[model samples]
Structures are given as C-alpha cells and as structure tokens.
Target: MERLRRRLPPLTALVVFEAAARLQSFTLAAQEMCITQAAVSRQIRQLEEHLGNPLFIRNHRSVALTTAGQRLFGAVDESLERIAQASTEIRGDASDAVTIAATICMSTYWLMPRLDAFQQEHPNVALRLFALDREVDLRAENVDMAITCGSEGQRHGVRMAHLMDEELVPLCSPAYLAGRVLREPGELLGERLLNLDREHWRGFNWAVVDWAAWFDHMQVRGTLPAARLAFNNHAQQIQATLDGRGIALGSPRMLADLLASGRLVEVLPQRLNTRRGYYLAINEHSTRPRAVAELQGWLERVSHAAMA
Candidate 1:
C-alpha cells in the first residue's frame, strides 16, 4: 500500500480529474463534486504536475482531454467502478432502507406530507430521511436519493427527473389581507413584508426572489420597502407568514396544502417563474438497488401528478 501510494497521485485528485474529464467542463465537475471550480482546477494541476504531463487542453469555454488524460481516465474510471461495486457487495443488504436526503424546507413543506402515502403503498420497504439545510454530497453521504433545487446547467452526472419549476408569488394569511385590496405591486410598499436574512445565507448563495427583485420583475421602480421581519431559515419565514406577521414571496409547490386549505392566499395575481426548479437526484452507485428504484419511481409519479 505504501509503495502504491508513493507511485500514484492522490486518490482524491484522481477522482476529481475523472469527473472533469468525463464532464468536459470544470464548472460542471465542480457542481457534480460539490466543490469550487478553482478547486477542481487546482486538483487537476496537482495531478498533472505529479505525472509530469499535461492532461487537458484548456480552451476558453471548455476543456478537452489529452491522450495521456484519456488513458488515465479509462484506468481510473474502471478502478473506481470496481471499488464501488465491491463496496456495495460487501455491505450487502445488512441495513436495508431507502435513505433520502433533502433540504429542510423541502422536507418539511413538500416531502413530509406525501410520505404516508408512500408507506401505505410499500409497507415492507423501510425508509430513512435526512433533512439538511446545506449542500450535501450524495456520494459521500451514501444517500440513495436527494431532492435538489437548482438550475439545469448546475445538475449533471446524475439520473434526475424534473419535479416543478420555481414559481413565486406574494402570499399572506387571510387575516393580514383583512378586507384590504392590493391591486398594484406598488401597494405592497405599504404593507409589512417578510423576508429571509441575507446575511444568514451568505455562504449558501440563495438566489430566491426577494422583495427588491420581485419589485424589479414587476417593473415597480423606486426604493424598495424595508422588511417587517427576517428569519435565517425559510421554514421560520414561512411560519411567520402563516401567522399573519406579513406577506411573503412563497412557492406554491412548497405551500400547496396551505394555499389549498385557504390558510395562505395569493396577495397579487402575478407569479414569477424562474429557470430553477426542484429535481430528484438518484445516487449513481445505488441505482441498482430495488428499494432505491421504487422510491425514485414513486417520487416521479407523485411530483408529476402535483405539477399536472
């Protein structure tokens, strides 16, 4: 092992190189590996230096593998696949459960309500759910499935299916509306608006529609009103909106039940559709498991029905 370690470049760098070569884009590789593009470049550079040979021809917008890169990629890809298969066989079905990872907001507002139906349909399949609010690596965490929200370009190298596009609209409890009329977007300037604390999510790079962006989209020119309240978590912000604290920009997919039950109502008729949406991401290593496949199919059917 020591001799092999000295003869080879870092295993992590090899993995990163394989992703970059396979995807043909550092940006895409970074997204797939859950790292920064610069980090991917750095790892590739280190591997190249160790081998004393250039592996990639870097162009302005894309990268192409050199002959040496092609050879190394073939070897590394096969070795990794074998390792993954061996690991799976060794682990076997000792812990048989379809483990799913998702954002806290997604788990609470979107997924939790539908779980009972899944249980009823597949009674013998045990399930484990992890509600995380930060970025998670499906491979590293050994998650069978993940509910991810992002732009199309950002999601690559995974068997994914479209769930729903992000649709945002101003929402408030009926109590806050209280026989008042809000016809124009400008009228919202007079009401208390709930928002997410930008400082709290500084690292997450959350690009959700804020009051300023919503106003710009509506062509309401002027200084935007300050937020009446702000919370670090989306779930908290949603709870405040439900409590009639203020109107909030809400996603119908997340608040479908509330809107249907009349607990939350759209303040204005306008809805903003962004290019981003939710998706079901299946782990590449776990695709062969029967339970994983069943859950994936269920999610697709359920999401499609909801979107319809």
Candidate 2:
C-alpha cells in the first residue's frame, strides 16, 4: 500500500486537475479553488509530468481537454460528487432541506398556500420546492419526492400514494362573469371558454382526461362555442381565469383558496372525475421519509377540507 501510494500522483494534483478539466480554464479553476491561476497551471504541469501525458492543450486564450483529460474527468467528477454526497449524509443535520418536485398548478395554486404552515410546524425540517410542468426522474434529479398528476401506473420504480383525485369543474373570476348568469351547466356555452391543447399528449398512452370528455359527460351536444382563449397547462389557465381571460376547468380541491377568497367562483355544481389524480411519489434513496410522509398527511387533510 505504501509503495502504491508513493507511485501515485499527489491527491492535491488530482483535485486541481479535476477542477481545471471541468471548468476548462486555469483561471476559472483558480477562482473556484481560491488559488492563483499560476498555481493551478503549476499543479496541472506537475500532474502531467507525473503521469507522462498531457491532460490539457493550452492555446493563446483558451484551454481544451485532451483525450486523457476527458478519460480522467469522467471518473474524477463522478467520484467527487459521490464523496460530497457521502459527506452530507454523514453530517446528518436535522435542518437539511428535503427537495420536493411539484407540478406547475400544484405548486402555484395548491401547495404554495399550505407550505408556510408546514414550515411553522416543523421549523427544523427544511423544504425545497422544484416547480416544473414536465415529470422529472426523481433519483436522477436528486429530488426526495414529487407531487405528480396522473394515473396510479403512470410512473414506474416509485411507489405512489393518492393525495387527491382531480375533479374537473368550470371556474371564472367574478369579474369575468359580471352581469352574466349561469343558470345551468349549458349556460357556460355563451361565456368565453379557456381550452388547453391536449393533441401532443394524445400521442402518449397515458390516461389524460380533457374538456371534450367533460362536455360529452354533461350531455352538451355538438357546436357549443369556439374557444376564446387557449393555455398549455392548468397553472397559466387558472391565472388567466383570475385575470378574467376566460372560464377555465379547474380542480376545486386545488383552487379552494381562490374560491374562498372570492377571487374565483364555480360556474355550476356539475363536476366530472378525471382519470388524473395527485400522487406523492417517493424516491427509493430518500432518507427523510418521515418528513415526506408528514407532508402527504397534511395534503390529505387539506384536500378533504377543500372538498367539504
């Protein structure tokens, strides 16, 4: 072991090389390592001398990784990342933030309003919310858990616990319906309808429920009205509704705060159950199951209250 250690290049030299290879600039590596640029250059030269091979090809104003540098970088970068993760785990701070991947609508309308109370109750348990429309790979993204909107079998390799089944109901801001009345479900045909394009999604075999199904379920026949507005997702759809853009189909459980605050109103009592639902997907490597489980429980309570 001693002989092998003596034969190997210095660990510091490898560290310097890793940074330089990643940044592709001695100056940037120096800034990252809090050392002079000359020091980084010297370390790289020493490493090359030890290995009998050049790792970087230095030009007048730029540096590029040599074939050898690329080979070493792939391993070194992965090793350093693993080391950092291990260090974090060893520290084991109770206040370490757990990351949650939330959908656009869920993050904006449903989860945001309830987050403050969760923080207040568990001050030591920190939280981080990643809001994006696309479904994320939990393990690859280093996310602890996710709030997904789809059927139970949409995602694989992760266990899901149903938070709430999304019920489609038409909603509009009070201003949008001013001087207009909705005596029945069909009365909304005269109002400007906000529709989302589900054509791209129709290509996938996922159980995506849309407006046409809802209209058919309500028994409202052909040639109702043209869409006055269109949106890509429920988040923007709800915002447009709030801004009086048009009447949008929304989940009552998710839009309860707006309804209670009088920012939005339900168009009619008729609501359709969609194939989609909100589920909590737990990562296989997640260490903070208790924190995520608490959040799941809180959501169940909130959804029930909203429906009530």
Candidate 3:
C-alpha cells in the first residue's frame, strides 16, 4: 500500500482535475476551488504530465474530458462523493445541523427568540440559519427549508406549510401619537409615513403590501402621505418606527411582541387581510432527511403557537 501510494497522482491535482471534468469548464472549476483559471489549467497540466496522458481536450469556449480523462473522472467523482457521504454519516449525529433559510425580519424578531426553545428540546440537532431577504432555492442553495411569503406552494414537489397569515396594519411608536388625534386609516395620510420602498430596492419586494394597498383594502382611496422616511428592508423600517421616526405598515407576525409590549402601536384599527402569507417550504422534491424533518416539525409547532 505504501508503494501504491507513491504511484498515485497528487490529490490536489486530482481534485482540480475532477472539478474541471465534472463541470466541463476549467474556469468554473477554478471559481469553485477559489483559484484562478490559470491555476486550474496549471494543475491539470501537472497531472497530465505525471500520468503521461492528456486529460482534457481544450477548445474555443470550454474544455471537455478526453476518453482517459472521462474514465478517471468517473472514478474520482464517485470516490469523492463516497468520502463525503462517509464523513457526513459519521458526523451526522453529533453535528446534524438544520439549515433554515428565512427572511431577515423573521430571523431577528421571530426565530431568534424561539430558537432557544428548539435548542433546549433538541440539544443534539444544531440549527443553521441563513437570514436574508433574497430568494433561496432549496435545491440549488442546499437549504433544508425556507421561510417564504406566498399564497400557495411556489415549487412543484416541495411541501408547503402555512406559517403565519399576519394582519397588515400601520405601526408607530406611542410617542408618534403624542398630541395627535388619530381616528382611522384615512387619517394616517397626514402623518409622516415610514415606507418600505419596493419600487427601487434590494431585499423583500413587499411594495404591493404598502400603504396604497392598505388604503385600497380599507376601502379608502386618496393620495398617499409623502414618505417622510423610507427603508429598503422592513426590519430597518420596523426599527425606525419603533424609535418614533414615523408610522410604518407592519405585520402582527413581525411586530406582535412589540405591539403587545406597548413599544409599538397600530395607527389604524383596520388591518389588511392579505392573501400573501409566510410559509414553510421544504425540499420534499427529494428525500426529507431526518435532521430537516426534526427542525421542520419544531418550526411548525413554534409557528402554530405564535399564530395561535
């Protein structure tokens, strides 16, 4: 075995070669390996020189694996995958973390507080959260589940569970209402509105769920109050509204605690019953791994309790 090891190709070169062959692009393999394309080509050249056989047939656009390269690629790909699977299986129980991709606001306001409870119950099951406002494809991103906003299941074969259908209403700090006679939804048009600009922004595209839509829902129509302030993210808007900067259209799901604690108050009695709601979507397109199932179950329970 020691003598056989001396005859084996360099593992580093093999790794680069496998990536280049599998992806069919040296540049892509380089990107995946966090190295330059030249580095990938150099490694491949070194491997080919050692083997005394050309591995890849380079062309104008991209490179393709030669017959010998294809045979080697098949073996290396399987070997690497097996190694990874074995490693994962061995470490699965001790460090089985559930990767949950959620909205920035939900992660901050909802998940952060409830995460302790989940951890307490499932001490062994580690939790990994990708808190962002961008859309995440569970399959592409390798996330177990995503907390998403939608009316129905967005992806075929993906399992969807209702998380929260929170009432959309105007929110403001109690200080914002000092010396002001607030009556109804229409009255808020005169107030300094903290808007979530969806027209031009990065992150949550909830512009349709704004004051204009709220007004339409309330059966009141008029020119919207000029946004005294606006934030790209609702989490930021929630914070600004909490500080008494202005009135922001907020959700009971995100601001329920604040609303209950008197840190923030709804400006209008009327709330928008939106068709759009937050959902727990799992990549049931494939096998539902136990670790994913464990976290999903806990999340459903937590969500049910919160919305209850």
Candidate 4:
C-alpha cells in the first residue's frame, strides 16, 4: 500500500489536472467535475507537489502549461483514453448495441418512422431506445446517447450537436375549426385551448399558450376559455387535439405526419420560434461505441435532410 501511494498521485488530483489541461481553464474543469474552482486548483497544486515540478505558469487571468506539464498531460491523456476505450469495448461486447434516450413524442413521431431505414443500413447494430420525459444523467443511467430540446449554452462534459430548430404553431382538426369564424387571432378566445405543461412550454412566458401571447404577437386582444383539460405530456395534448378535443400549440416536426394525413390542420399558418430546439448530447467521458457512432451519424444526416 505504501509503495503504491509513493508510485502514484491521487486519482482525483490526476483527473482534475487532466481536465484543466485539456480545457485550459481551471473553472471549466471544476464545472465539468462538479467541484469548486478552488478544489481543482488545490488538486492541481497537490499533483504538481507530488511530481516535484510546476505544471502551469500563472499568467494574468489565465494559465499556460509548463514543458513538464505538457509532457505529463500527453502521457496522462493517452493512458486515460486507453482505459476508457477498453471499458467501452468490454461493455459493447455484452450488448453489441447502442442505447438512445429520447422523449416519447420524438420517438413516436420522428424516430420510429425512420428506424427501419437505419436498421437496413446497419443490420448488425441493435438500437435500443428509451422514451422518457425527464432529463437523465447519461453516466449514471448508462445511456449511450440522448436527444433533448434545449439551447447548447451551459451544458458541461457533454458534446452537444444542434439537430433542428423547432417552430410552434396552433393546430386543430380542420373539421373542428370549420364553421368557427376565425378571421383574426382574437377569435381563438371562444375556442378550447389544450395545454401542454412541459419544460418546453416554459418559454411561452404567459404561463400557458393562452390567447394573450397569441393575440399580443398578432397585435390583437383576445380571451381564451379556461383550460378544460391539461396534459403534462406533449404527445397526450397532441393526441387530444387530433381527437378534436381542442386547439393545441403543436411543434411542426412533431405533428407533420398528422397534418399530412389530414388528421390535423394548422389553425394559424404563422409559426412562433421557441427558445428550445433539439440537441444531440453525448457524454464526454464515455467513448462512443461503433453502434452509437453510426446512430449519431444517421441522426445528423436525417435531421439535416428534414431541415433542408
């Protein structure tokens, strides 16, 4: 035990040092590791002390690696990367598959339809999908990849790729909207407004997509009937709208099939841009397996084609 301790620095210190060296910022490394900046600095200091050399030269408001630090970082990075790669290879052999976490609506409305094509292209890869509403920790959950709706602004230790920009518009069955004199946005006041109470709706700013924002955006005044039925799930709200329950603010991509099938109609042709858009997030520490890499490539290609 004593010999081991003498031969090696603490794993925490090594990890902290590696992250700081890779990102070139102690603060960012701290954020990625879910630790304080001070803690990261202390760990790096400890690592430098153990090695009997200065790792970083403190410049004004920034840091630069010393020659010894650069050499050490290269060795440490390669070693850690190899360990991660080996672990992923071991895990991949058991399942020989990729696991993707996505929202229920995305899975049902978007991915399910195109899954056959993906399978056809990569027959050997098994794609397992988890349809969920809540955000998951990829590391803790063992999720290979995840597609979620958000701006890639503040996420750390995850590689985020922008998929598509989503536009929201009010929609209802054409039969339901027929004979309802709706010349202006204010006319929606008398209509039943189905509510989708999800995280995506947070940016609506009116607490609900009521007549207020719609009318305000259209430069009109209107009142909407109190929500008769509210659903926390977007799929449920959309399904309710399809059944002619009420008008719902629908995502263009989510309701594309229903609209094409004549099961639903856009109440207003004008689309509203929301703060959220679909993003592909991969955990930084997790090595992308062969199947996962293939799926990620397919998703990027398909999403880009749809947008184009």
Candidate 5:
C-alpha cells in the first residue's frame, strides 16, 4: 500500500501533466490553467517522477510526449473530461436553489421591497442574494444571475439584458424648497450641494455630477460652495437630503418612496442622463434554471412598473 501511494501522482500534478501532454505545449497549458509555464513544467516533472518514467522529450521550442505519456494522457484526459461533464449536468439539474448578485443600494432600496412577493409566489424556490458593489464572475462565483450598472461592453461569456436607463435629477427636502422659490436650474448653484462620495460613484467619471457636473450639465455658471457633507452610500445621502441638508443628485428609483411621501421634492424638472444604467447578466455557458428565470421575469416586471 505504501509503495502504491508513492507510485500514485498528486492530483495537481496529474491535472498539469494531462493539460500539457494533450496540448503538446506547457505554455498553452499554463494559459488555460491560469498559471506560469514554469509551474506547469514543475508539476509535469513531479508527475513523471511519481510514475518512474520520463513523460516528455523537450525539444528547443516544443515538447512531445513519450509512448507511456501518450497512453496515460489518453486515459487521464478522458477520465477528467467525464468528471467535468458529470459535474456540469448535476449542477444544471439542481432545483432547490437560486443565487442572485446585486448592488447594496439596489438590494436595500429596490429588491428587498419586492422580494417578499417573489417568495410568496414561488414558495419552493430557495433564493439567495449576494449584495456587493464589485462585479462578480457569474460562472466562477456560482451565481445564477446578476444586476449590474454600467454600459454594456466586453463581458466575455455573459449575456446582458438592458434593465433601464438611469436618469439623475436634483432633489432636496420639501421643507428646504418651500420658502426658496428657485425657478430654473441655475438657482441651485447658490444652495448647498450634497455629494455622494467617490466609492458609490465608481465608473461615473463626471466630477461635474459630483456638484460640478450637475451644475455644468445645467449650464449654470459661477463658483459654488464645496459639498456640505459627503456620504459613501446613496441611502445616507438620500436621508441627509430628506433632513433638509442640501440638494443631491438622486436616482429616480432610489428616491421613489421619499417623493411619494412628499418628504423630498424635485429641485429642477430637467434630468441629466447618466452614462451608467442597470442590466441583468447571465452566464452564456449555462441555461437559466427555472427559479432564476422566474426571478428575472419578476425583476423586469417591477422595473417596468416603477418606470411607468
């Protein structure tokens, strides 16, 4: 048994050897495995040592497998491929769970409000929400779906569905706007402007929207006072605006409740189109499971209704 244990190659070494042998190039195998070519060479050497045979003949710029290496590669490659196919099939048929990734502010203000309805409608579906600001790799993260804010660009193997075009409008506490009668967008230049800090505004390059951008977009001239207070989260910024702190550039959906309750009022009717917008993303390699499909449908419906 001890001799057999010594004869057996480590799983990592086997994986490296199989990849290198099949591709006939350590460099290509390293690229596929996301490791250095040196690492792949070391692993294959270790694998050869375990089997007590030299696996490959290293030429000036290429490697060719030995007769024994070719035989082992054929068996190992087929075995690993079968294992991968089985795992994928099993994961696809998993019926009890669905995982979704969304931003913190969207999860808090948007999804949380409507998720109960989804639960009640689809009682058997166990839903998990991962609230994060950073974009997650759907396949790598095992996420069934994700909601992201940005322009659609080079997402390698993901399908993107446009959710909505986000528009930013100036908002302030109703009390703050009550006595002060500012007719046009220019008037807001004199009032205090509250800025949501850089973290929440990542990918939004317009510093003018950070008090400077909004004013510039409105074509308002003249110097303005610095931001009265800066918040890392939109929720806090909205709360401050509600408390009559200052005017803020608010997302139409984020301040829906405050607008309905008359706590916040639109400072200007004109809205600026932001470069960023919300989107639904799914892995192209995987079909949407039933629960994930249902959730996606529900989100689209809710977003459309909100916009309407």
Candidate 6:
C-alpha cells in the first residue's frame, strides 16, 4: 500500500487520462468528467510528466493515443473497473434493478417488444434499458449486461456469449416497393436508397453494410447509385424506410416482428450474412448477480428462439 501510494500517479489524473484515452477526445472526456477541456489537458500533461512519456498525439480536431498512452489506459481502465466492482460489492447494494445496455436499433426494434414477457415472469425485478448508438464500457457505466454486435471475445471483467449472427436483407415499406419490380439486384440502381454512413459507423466497430458492399455482394456490376438518404445511425435510417422513403439493408432477425406485421417487406429472396454476430456481455462481478443471471437466461432463450 505504501509503495503503491508512492509509485502511482494521482488517481484523479488517472481517471481523466483514462476518459480522454478511451474517448479519444479531450473535449468529450471533459464533458464526461464534468471538467473544463483545459483541466483535462492539464491532468493529461501532468500524468505524462509523472510517467516520463508522451501520452497523446494532439491533432487539430482530435487526439490519438501514443503507444504509452494505450498501455497505461488498458491497465487503468481494468483496474478502475475492478475497484468499482469491489466497492459496489462491499456496499451490499440492495437494489433489484437490472440494467442492460444495447444498440438503439436492437433496443427499439427487438428487445423493447419482447420485454413484457420477462416482466410478467419476474414482476419483482425492474429492468432498465440503456440504449445508445455507440459502444460503451459496460463495467464503467454500471451496466449489468450488454447486447453488442461484434466478434466473440472477453472484454475487461466481462463474460460474453454469442447471441445471434446478423442476417441482413433489403427491406422497405410496402408502399415503396408497390410500383417497383425489383427482380434483380441491378434493378435497385433506379430506386432511392436509404443508408447508414460508413464513416459515421467506423468508430463503433459495427458491421456496417453500405450500399457499395451490398451491391458488390449481390454481384451488381456498375457504378452504384448514390444514397438519396444517409443516416448517422440505424434508427433514423430505419425510420426513413418505415416512412416509405427508401429501401435499406436491415436484419431480419431483429426486425422479424415488423416483417410479420407487414410494416416492412423483404425486397429480395437472397440475403447477406455479414459474418458479424450479436453478443451478450455480462459484468461478472455485478452487485445484482441473481437478476443479471435471470436476464441472461431469458435473453439466451429469446435469441435462440429467434434464430430457430
């Protein structure tokens, strides 16, 4: 303990550094830490000085971590998560609330619709859904579990289970397809397409199938048509599709209810399997262990039913 106190940089500075490094933006780190951008910068500078290594490559509009920065961040983030978990356990939190984080589209289109059954089954457990368009630190955010789309792997202090593979098909409102005879992929060139911007999705590590990728997968050989509508997130793009604006690539498993209800229609018999999959990640040291376990079991059963 004495050695740690002497050797470790200030915990506050480490917190600021971790936020800035994880976010890759001093301004965002400041906003999250509830401090000024200058304060964040100063803490980062002090930490770098303490470690005798440059931590960040400051850019005109952004920041990138130096190798040293990445290394420190990996250690700091995991350590903080462990500390937080230990503290929570020590406190013996008695809340029965279970929080699950997921992508906005998955929450809105898939999980939200099916939550009633779970609620009915366990009336005493309160469920909170944290829906965001971007990935988040599950332990840092105090999320008991998260449904994410990515390759299967162990994240820091988290256990992951494969939920389902993402299956995409061309979808549009029935009104949009009424007048169009899209017998082949090439015929789609004439129609207005709704798309999620690939550039916007890069940071999230999502498996984004842009128009070019979809066209190439379908073996359509020509200059693909420009998207008439591009959304920064899936929810907006899906809304536009539902409003009969344009056709979009969407998951059949996630939107199965919508398709069955005739709110949307599949445009082609073929499908694109992006090879990416949705995963359920649970914080192994959650305070509400029983609640988390119950939700995890329910999610696995529901997802398996969907895939079946």
Each prediction's TM-score versus the true structure? 0.78, 0.67, 0.67, 0.69, 0.67, 0.78
Residue 237, candidate 5: Cα error in Å is 1.7
Clashing pairs in 3: none
Error of 3 at 79 (Å): 15
Q: Using lDDT, give the best candidate's number.
A: 6
- lDDT tens string, model 6, 144-259? 88899988876656899988898788999999978666788888888888888878888776757777878888889887777767888798888899999999999999898999
Question: Once model 2 is optimally superposed onto the true structure by TM-score, how far is the C-alpha of residue 137 displaced, in angstroms?
Answer: 0.8
Worst 10 residues of 6 by lDDT: 88-97
Worst 10 residues of 2 by lDDT: 200-209
Q: Is candidate 5 or candidate 6 better by TM-score?
A: 6
Best by TM-score: 1
lDDT of 4 by residue, 1-308 (tens): 98987799888899889889877889878998999999999999999988899999987677889999999998888787677668767777346567788888888888788889999998998877899877766754667788887677655456788888777888898778776646656677778888865455565322344445655677765555786888877778878888889888877776667788888888878777766688888866555456677888998998888768
lDDT of 3 by residue, 1-308 (tens): 99998999999999999879867998889998899999998999999999999998999998988999988998887787567556556666335567788878888878788889888988887778899887776754557788887675456436888888867888889998885768877787787888877765544434347788888877887888677787767788888988889888778876677888999887767788887788888876323378678888888887778777
- Alpha-carbon lDDT, every model: 0.83, 0.80, 0.79, 0.78, 0.78, 0.87
User: Candidate 5: where are CA atoms >4 Å away?
Assistant: 1-95, 199-209, 285-288
At residue 160, give the lDDT of candidate 6. Answer: 90
Name the weakest run of 10 consecutive residues (lDDT summed) in model 4: 203-212
TM-score quality measure for candidate 2 = 0.67
Predicted structure 6: lDDT: 0.87
Q: What is the lDDT of residue 25 in candidate 3?
A: 97
Misplaced by over 4 Å in model 6 are 1-83, 86-95
